[model samples]
Target: MALRGLPTPLPGLAISSLLLARPAIAHDHHGGSEIPEGQTVSVEPLDTTLWIHIFVNMFAYGVIFPIGMITKSRWHVPTQIVGSMLALLGFFLGHAHGGREFVGNNVHGLFAHILQILLIAQVVLGLYLKGHWEKGINGFIRKLIRPCHSIIGKAMPVLSWTQMIFGGITALGFCQGEYTGQCAAHFIMGSAFIAYGILLTIILLVGQVWMRQTGRSQEFYDSAVIAAWGCVNTFTEHHWGTAWVRNDWQHTSMGIIWWCAGLAGIWMSRDRDGNPKRNFIPGLVIAITGWAMSSHPQELMVSEATHKMFGHTLMAAGLTRIIEVAFILGDKQSLTEDGRTWNSFQFLPIFLLYTAGFLFMGATEEQMLLVAGSDMDHVAYILILFSLASLVFLFANMLVHMYDRLANPTSSKEMNGYTGVNGRPMEEGRIRDAEEFELEGLTSDGEADDEGRGMLRRSQEGHRSQIQGVPLR
Candidate 1:
């Protein structure tokens, strides 16, 4: 009767079957029907102390050590050396701090970390062997170090790539984490450090290879000078936002220093001969442009009342221009007659480009200031000053060119022999005679022709007479 009231029970649905089905339906409802398989476990975060230690180690070993090897200033050497030592100390401290944490938290990771450290140490040692410890009592030590240094030097590119991969993995993990502030900072700083390390490694390798190829260890020093200048330029330009963080004094001072480096590099690379006048025009233009870009006062967008300035920009521009011009002139002066003409007008194109590019760049800066809600007065003032300076330099160069052209219209065709100061023929009669003698295959024995013979005999007689007149000791 109960089955009839239910209107039908399935043939397989007995009381036991119904009871078992109830439990299965309950399990499904409670999400216990199936278990997930092969899920990935999350990696634990690295200890903060360990991270900091690694950061410090990287800065010291990767940055400071390489810099010391490159820079060689008598006055600054002690300070740099001391700083490098301090960085090394910091590296060890950080490594110890991190190593302890790594040992406790990540037994397996500890070996990988150690391997990374060892590789980095190898690179640092190689750099030291190649530069800092190349000479003196440690020379024998260097001999032993050379094979390792060579191996590491070759492997640097690989190491750099590995670092990048690790850094990217870390960054990805950080991005996925809930600690937004800490993770973001970690990701940013880590990426930046990795990038910097890669660049440093590349620069070191390049410098080493360059030294080997040129057989000029001094070239490494020269590259260091360029790097120093670049750093200064970067600081002045506030490339890393240094200007925003630091006081004007710091930026200005740094800018000056960087300009000096550029100037020094230019001076060092100069052609041995002097004649900077022609080169000066282009140099002046570039200098003026650089100055306009860097130091000319422009109102800040955030604060119209405040002005943004970078003195180093102008200083670098000026010094670089002068140096470039001087080098050009020097090169021109040293050229053979055939090559001199080729180099003569080289400065002209450089000047034209400088003038055009700077003019455009300055104008762009002005527009940027305007968009930033800066006061037009400051912009106008800067524009005027920059334009005036540029014009003055341009006119001065033009005047010099005009004067040169006027003084010697046929200067180019004349094999650069038309010196305005001295209209005397560049090749004297003696030089012409020597050239003619060589062309004619004549000996100074009164032999080629009657005229040549007479001239040769007369020259001999005159020389003999002069010698005879001088009393013998």
Candidate 2:
């Protein structure tokens, strides 16, 4: 995962060779069909109104909601509330016009319904906060509220991306019939979804360690399952023991490596001397995720090169994390928060992706480039510059959050104000640790049996503080 020591020649050769030999790559990867020599796929206008609705859906749910979650400003709530309503409206309209046909499959329809429920639930949570009261909800439901909030909250981005990708895949191309061929757009974005999933797994594991959850048999169980899948994906993607590993394959291979490292940590943790060393796995995870997206074909091309630069920046941050973890653990200190706190250095990669995502938006415009440097397009370059401006905006927002955390920090008594995952302020004072979040049927005070709900340790006065009502009128 460390870019400095790892040789790049293998991946470089793989990319170059793939480009030169793509004709023979067996077009069986995506589907049996192939695009006629010079044709390409594109976004459609089921008319202007449909096009506008979907983009608005994408921007509101994918962009604005996530940005609010990342920055966690109080001002973000009003905007997010508005965006949620708009996104829900858009979902209904889009579904009526486009997604209705897919209901027979059950998969897409199920997810669509889940997303709608999540949106309604989020709106309810926002209003509850605005009300500054929780009498209408139950104590246990309130205790489990943040975790529920977090699951749906974190899911919105992944769910949005899923819907978008499938929507694109299922829709007829603007200029053609069904697009049953390989889509570069789908591949790139789909890989990001996988990458984000792995990251959350690692972050949750690391968070548990910092909070002193030493008894982690369940944690190991989860890691073992994820690693097993990674191992399966490794072979499935053709990345094992091969001389030339494709960049996409490298991603799965690294997932395998990360899982192996995690398994090692789990085994070692039983030795009583391995507590300080258990964090190496997560550090390596960050490093791998950082570089996994770097080794693609257009590594040095226009915005493609910029994307690689973005990848390396994340790699550097990963290396820094590794070093920091070593230093802190060596001195018998706690592990740093990953993505949950305003004070976390863990937010770095998230920021990198958002800013870099815009750059990649135009990187996909490579098909528009003409022959030779003389006829090349400048749109991607302009977008790359716009991405940098976005970086500045994000940087400024991060600075404000850091400043706020310093200026108006929360105490253990005010656990509700911490805004658990994705900035959804908890309705109940029950702040469950991320470790046992998945096992819903467990008490926060103790582990749960299979049939029981996870009992979250609701704060008495420690969990509740004086509430001042804000007039919604």
Q: Looking at model 2, which ten-residue stretch has the lowest summed lDDT?
A: 1-10
As a TM-score, model 1 comes out at 0.23
Please, what are the lDDT tens digits per residue for candidate 2 over residues 234-253? 55444356666455456556
Error of 2 at 276 (Å): 5.5
What would the per-residue lDDT of candidate 1 be over residues 1-473, giving only the tens digit for each residue? 00000001122122112112211111121223231232111223445655665565455444443343333223124534554565456545544531111111121223236445655566566456436454477778877776775565445433333343333333222222223222222223223222322332232222323323443323234334444544543443344544353334443444454455445544544335632213343234234433433443334542221122222333344464355335643523323423223343433333333333223222322234444564455456555535643653354344334333332233223343453335543333433444444434344222357787677667755754554465422
TM-score of each: 0.23, 0.47
lDDT of 2 at 42: 23
Q: Which 10 consecutive residues of model 1 have the lowest summed lDDT?
A: 1-10
Task: Evaluate all candidate structures by whole-model CA lDDT and list the values in order.
Answer: 0.37, 0.46
